[model samples]
Target: MTTDARALVPLPRSGPATAAGTRFRLHRAGIQNVWQYDEQEFAFGDGRLLLRGKNGAGKSKALEMLLPYLLDGDSRALDATGTGRTTLAWLMLDGFEQTNRLGYLWVEFRGTTDGGDHRHLTLGAAIRASRSTQKALPTFFVTPLRVGEDLHLVEGGKPLPVDRLKEIVGSDNITDRAVMHRSRVAPELFGITDATRYRNLTQLLHRLRRPTVGDRIEHGGLASLLSETLPGLDEDVVEKVARNLHDLDAVRDELGRLERTDTALRTFLTSYRGYLSGVLRTSAQAVSRELEVLAQRRRAAGDAAQRTSELRTQEEESEARLETLREEEEAARTDLAALHDSHAYRSLHELSEHRSTVEAVHTAAGAAFTALSNAHGAEEGAAERLADGVEHLGSRLAELGTEHRELLTQAEMAGLPTGHLGEAVALPRTVRSQTVETQLTAPDGETHTVQQRSVVRVDTATVQDGLGSWQLRPGHALPDGPTLASALRPAPQPGCGVTAEQVERLLTTIALAPAAETAAHDAVYHDGSWRLGILSGRHHKADA
Candidate 1:
């Protein structure tokens, strides 16, 4: 059972060895610029190569030529050094005037692996003004190379035609024809694969020309270049940290936006709350005023209701009195009607008619008396005229008597008979009355005789008969029979068998009834619900 401890332990293991890390070293760079330089060559020696030149002598330009080789023909690296591809192209073409001129940059480099094997490689790039673009944009081309076992098939020290360079590389051999692919080509030729290492080498060359002076090396400085170029650093870890930093920056931006939104929302809510408070205060004040007014209205309504009740009672009482008055009026009218039908009333009415007839007769008799007086004055005037005529006739008779005496005397002398002449000459001396006859036309169109008699005479029997028909007394009260009958005559009785005072009072009450009823109606319309207690007083409050 004794086992060898050395045999039990796992033997020191060894696997197939991996190819070592790669590095690129610049040897020489050639530039041909139509404007700044005709054709120039720069050589770099091992360890601390120093260049001395005047300010415009192409010192920077010579150093910048290494960029295309180190960065695998990335013209943007040249742009970082202030020599843009297009500017460099235009300068090569003699300040943009000779745009057709072609410029060339060729870099020769040595790549050494960790196993100590080394290879010689050349990176070639061409620049020319683009014919197709408005700014004469520079066009770049990487001159493809064909590496044999020991030499480069691509031409050196001269500009190669871009088409020939494409044919040499074969379309699939280069990733982009216009851009240099030294990184890809170097792996096949010298076994170099790390592109970041190549970029660091180029950056180191850039920093050598413009070394940073600060305590911490700035970006793209020698320290940063060395850190990136060291094989010990993990590329994947660096990339992951960079990604995490980017995500952190995005999170910070999102947080800032959220903070700003919160501030804005707070401000808006503050303003809105203030506005709402003001609105609510105004509404409260309005409601309070409305409530006060409603309270006053409620009190007034209560008073009105009380007054309405009182008025209703008065109206009912007045209505009752009116009904009673109406009944009394009907009874009085019935009594008055009965009184009118009584015999005493009839007798009184007849007496009144008789009195009216007597008065009419008296008025007619007075008119006839006036007419008779006028006729009597006319008769007196006629009598005076007749008397005057009779006096004259007597005087004539005296003169006739004297004439008869003389005739008797003459007859005695002549024996004539005088007695017969005296008798024949005798005349009467008395006034005689004459009758005047007048014919009057009556309203009936008949003519009647009116005799003007010396005396107007009345028929005693007709006068006696008229006197017997009516009793007449002067300076005495009307006969008791007519008086008693007039006293017994029917008169309209007072309404309701009530006095004029009671009727007047009833009329006054009726006049006041309408005003009371109107008040009651107004109360019913305005305060009906409240008076009947159907709704609370609060319900009467108006909206603000």
Candidate 2:
């Protein structure tokens, strides 16, 4: 294979039957080196060529590369990652119109940055080389017309920005112009197929003839098809038919207008009667619905009244129970107070105070005994000693008597007499502190407080049957304090029978007569009078 720079024109198969007069050709086709996958290539004579391969064999890639050539390089080139990189790749067709020409178009593509990575491009260009002028020479010129600059050739040395090149080629409508011109035989050059080629031919014919009929339709147009099918029927026929219909309609309208001119009282009355009948029929239906609604309301009110009565009855019973509870609670409270003031409770307190006083007296007595013992040890001697000892003994005896009397006085002050001081006595004692720890309600719905001062007094008695009965009573007279609990019985819940949905169902079931007046009269008539009499005399009773 040799690289030749000969200019050759490759033409569509339909334009010229022979190879002469053809301006475009596909000699060697392949994806540019920038694409990192399988390098797909194609070589074709010209029309209706298919590139067939397995998946990922780059068959579509071959088509994609050649697609831009026919579209005047308006398509975006793909990156190595199969992304449309928004770069315009130009493949110029330098077709030479000559007999027996061997020509090919050269394709050159530039790579752009995709996904933040720069793509390397080693794009190869293909140009047709004749058997005569076959040499390694550049065939196609790739130019970049930059912003505020003239068009410069983009050779292998320096490549221009892909975006600037894209803007220029795209604004020129280069691809679309090529498509319109080459659409007839070459299947529009872009995504060409057999079916698409036929469709494009059909569309071209329609486009060429469209303006004539389309203009007429857009601007006060005629129905040309109807005119066409009916040869003699033109715009004049349409005007004549429309005028005839208008005249007949005018005559019929005038007759109706003339008929409405009459003011006959009897006829008016007849029409009025029919209109009033319709209005009355509608009014009656509405009233019947209203009557049905009212009846439903009455029934619902009755049901509500029954439920309210039941609630009241329950309330009355609850109130009675509450009253009983109040009385019982009041009695319990009063008894509790009396128990606090009872002799047993007060006696326990008195006994505690007396015991404390007795302890004080006992301590004083022990001190006195020690002093008496010391005084007895101090005396000694013989005859004179005997007199001294007797006098000392008498003095010590007097001191013992005085100490004894003082003890008696202290015992009396402590509320224990001298005779009772020697006896063993037990007194009531408190083991716990008093407190009102909780409040609660009784069985009958009364609230009461439980305090630490309360206690259960138990008494066991032998009955005639030889069995002992233990009775427990709550009071404040015991040695221990009261016990308390929180909370009480719950309030009674409402009945489950009555509900809003049930009431609505009942309201829906009510019925009323179609005629309101008739229904009212019948209802009143059905409710008859009732009479009652009293017998007061014996004579009237005898006659009966």
The prediction achieving the highest lDDT against the true structure is 1
Give the per-residue lDDT digits (tens) of candidate 2, residues 1-544: 1111121222334544344222333333343222222123344444334544456554444444444432332233322223554222212212322222212223322223435432221112222223234221212222222211343224343333333444544433222233343442243222355544444443433333332656666775456543433335479889999998879978999878777765565688789999999999999999999999999999999999999999999999999999999999999999988988999979988999999988786666555444433332331112234334334433543443454454445434433324522222111122222333556444344665533232211111111011101111233221211111011112212442333333233223211111322332332222111000111221243243
Q: Candidate 2: where is the Cα deviation over 4 Å?
A: 1-25, 28-30, 33-41, 45-55, 64-160, 163-544
lDDT of the structure predicted as candidate 2? 0.38
Task: Return the TM-score for candidate 1, rounded to 2 decimals.
Answer: 0.30
Model 1 ranges with Cα > 4 A deviation: 1-24, 33-35, 47-49, 68-70, 79-86, 94-96, 111-118, 131-158, 167-544
Best candidate, TM-score: 1
Once model 1 is optimally superposed onto the true structure by TM-score, how far is the C-alpha of residue 94 displaced, in angstroms?
A: 5.0
Q: For each candidate, give its TM-score against the true structure.
A: 0.30, 0.16
TM-score of decoy 2: 0.16
